[model samples]
Target chain A: MTETSGFLTSNGMAIDLTDLTIDKAHKHLKSRDFSAMELADAYLEVIEKKNPEINAYLEIYDDVKKQAQQAQEIFESKEENIVTGIPLAIKDNILIKGKQASAASKILEGYTATYTATAAHKLIEKGAVFLGRANMDEFAMGSSTETSAFGVTKNPRDLSRVPGGSSGGSAAAVAMGGALAALGSDTGGSIRQPASFCGCIGLKPTYGTVSRYGLMAMGSSLDVIGPITKTVADAEIIFKAICGKDKYDSTSISGSINAVSPKKEYIIGIPREILEIEGIDKDVKENFEASIKKFESLGFKTKEISLSNIAYALASYYILMPAEVSSNLARFDGVKYGLHKKGANLLEDYLNTRGEGFGVEARRRILLGTYVLSAGYYDAYYNKANDVRRLIADDFENVFKNVDIIITPTTPTPAFKIGEKVNDPLSMYLADIFTVTANIVGIPALSIPSGAVIREEKELPLGLQLMAPHRGEHSLFMVGSQFLGE
Target chain B: MITRTDIEKLASLARIRLSEKEKSLFPEEINSVLGYVEQIKNADASNAKALQKETVYNVMREDINPDESGVHTKDIVDEFPKKEGNYLKVKNIL
Candidate 1:
């Protein structure tokens, strides 16, 4: 109920940016409590005050006021939808036509999107005001935002700590009150881990629910576009708007896949093998147990289940993800869009352009991918990884039949210090241990703020992840809303 | 283990030019990563079915010209790094 004083309209109607949710704002806008222009100005004021320190937004769109003006017109015409005038921060990887989407890598610097992504286009159709493009790890590769060519996005809670990536800025922008919600792509824990680190709700819907036509491809098989929001209901609102079949992306499924009715009670499955993994923070484990107890107290039953191939999920992800990255990124040669460097010959042109444009981590992944897919090692590395991926998927398939949902800690630890895992890539990869399985199995996963743990005298947020069967987003929302008391 | 020579070959195959510093450092870094993921080799996946085995199917759509298709061909062409008129100019393949 705390409201910032300066965000008042001419009629003295005050807007509360700190406690504003999509539904609240929609009701307020419909009742003429405040105009959409006023709402956007309020967020712009906060971003102006906070972004320099937080480094959450890479670019604040020049057309925000124009977009807000259009949204106000919709309100006047009484045609405003739920998302009309709701300001959102888009990850740099998801394109909006005429906007620059770099994916936080120099490789695609100055690249203007010729076409908007299906998800962003959906938001545009709903009259959502795009606040800005948020920063992320270059090409959505690193778990920490430190890999961004622009800069690392600091966690709003503690300026010294990282906002976990590769959707770090999207999460930070929401946490810092810059945007109501944001869109982020999860290849492996990109959206959920960052949301967990920044104390927000992030949902990665089933792999085919959201179209990937314009999301910068990282891992084609694993990548998904989802919402990062302040509340579970807000996340569901954005997901409903964006999820559906698209002729543009053949993999997209109909939105009706979420039409399943909510049950009276739900069963929560806990993977014993994942919790037994090494290097999980003591506090995170404790927080997860507390969350299970909270769910149990709410009449949800918890059962311990074993996923035999869960141990290899991360390894499978690392191999399969990089292999896909190598193939997808091959389009960034000198002749096409994005940064280009000229050389004496065609071969040298490709080498020079890619070498100079890509960051160290990007190059490293490309090389790793190339090595795995190489002729001699193809069967040994790439094929073997695929087989393990199948096994991991099978493990989830069998488990879902016994339980309605699975739960785990979103990340092994809360947000680490900005530079804690930068020099060590392996350590950074470990951050996705609990999150990668959802991506590997192509299921819907939701990460909600469980509670906070005090670290260094600052309260750092922790999150618990709930994963449902394929296209089981309704169950996730039902349990998530009950858990968050929304 | 990935050697420096192997790193060079990968960089070459990937069409990326790595500096000598990268060449020297990547062997160790890639080896560590490969070492971690190498555990999958021991996984027994004989009973597991291939991904997309039943799901893989061609999605056919009627072909349409760029003008009729609603695709912004001009915008796509405008993104080319080096363009001569409407055609993208690339280095000679021969």
Candidate 2:
């Protein structure tokens, strides 16, 4: 089972653990083809070789062997669950009790979580072994992992280009076979955009379908945790495991997920108005059109519709997200639990602790948020943004009445070179133009690696994004699986 | 464009000290981003129905007496950065 490519190439062992998907891995483990310990070791071997170049994992759990030992015991006792012995990577922002979850920022350096995030807790209870915490944008603020306080995570496909952001490390880990699957939160395209850039499947579940409890708050209204996996079925499996209500988060809903079996009928709507955006790469647009044609060949209907208000989605999100960020991030003062720097007095302490703790992008957003929420400007900026947000949601509601799912290019371009737009924050934010509307409307969306385009003799992946009506994840998986021919 | 004086006010309100360089740099960045978000002003809200949040509601939990609910008061208090036995320590404002 040794191979020149695709997982465990460096190991050159007879037992190839890299190519095993979730289903195959479960079958092999159940049949005792190899022990769970063996599987964990094989992944650890790959991480050792690849992580230095990729920088995907921030911290590999020291207790991996101990966790795998417990998982092996569970498997031997005939208590196997959906994710038994499955080693998954977690985003740094998600909390696991007694673990250093820093969200890749200096503000919470050396901070340990006192309790586990409800999502991670659910997986742990099912005998899933967390391999490590993945690196991400500091405070989940940027579109590229370059903003991370730790280091920039390079794209596994091309070392020079970024692996997209916020969830860049999670997507890269899964793409490089370092982890079978990983969890990432989407606030303004953090998950899907990276999932696309790194060539993986990333889902952003309908807001409130998955509990946000214990995930370090970014944009509170825009964040939803979902899975980044190698396959759509794996995404479905992880989604079901983590999607449920918890009393800890009042926003979570109980069993509100759409249970309708994916209908065989396929009617995909394309927002012609939004698709005709400026600055879309030639290859990306051509590939996007080619993906649409592939859907047509598979007996799916394609309709060109107008979602005119979608043009303003990015604008609305920028305003609303910062406004919420300014408020949510106010808690990290020099008090209680994180980094505390003493100064002359109370005011100086607050200023010094925050000024030194927060990164440039974070401080910029906070100031922008403050300005928008200031007394005289509140109605002009924040309120107007909310009204436009309502309009964008209404546009989706109207378009969805005639279409099962809306399709778009996940990003305007493939992974860009690191430092290409780092200095220009607005240009950096434009990378999320196509992916942010779903967050704005509180709907389920996914980014599936559509195809690849070669640049500098390297194949960088491009993703096709699909947006479904509220709780319409079933439709996304249905169409997504069909498109991927899984 | 927002002036440096306005940004100074924002920094004071946000309680974050900005250096001389940041004071100049942040205003330019903030103003550019504001320019981008200014497009929202075109959407009229005068007659539109108030925006409704799909998932926000007042949650009520049963009042469990401390005896019935197993509360770890010590563990909760231990999370504070500076604690004096069972109480939290903070700088005096008076």
**Number of the predicted model whose DockQ against the real structure is largest:** 1
**Across residues A1-486, which tens digit of lDDT does each residue of candidate 1 receive?**
112537888679878788899999999989989988999999999999999999999999999999999999998988889999999999999999999999998878999999899999999987999999999999999988888999899999899999999999999999999999999999999999999999999999999899999999999999999999999999999999999999889888885766656788899998866777899999998999999999999999999999998999999899999999999999988687998898889998899999999999999999999988889999988988888988888888889888999999999998899889998899999999999989988999999999999999999999999999888999999999999999
Residue pair clashes in candidate 2: none
lDDT against true structure, model 1: 0.91
Q: What is candidate 2's lDDT per residue for A102-215, written digit by digit as tens? A: 889888888888789999999998889899999999999999998898999989888899999889999999888788899999999999999999989999999988999999
Model 1 ranges with Cα > 4 A deviation: A1-5, B50-53, B66-71
| DockQ of structure 2 | 0.64
Lowest-sum lDDT 10-residue window in model 1 chain A: A1-10
Ten-residue region with minimum lDDT total, candidate 2 chain A: A1-10
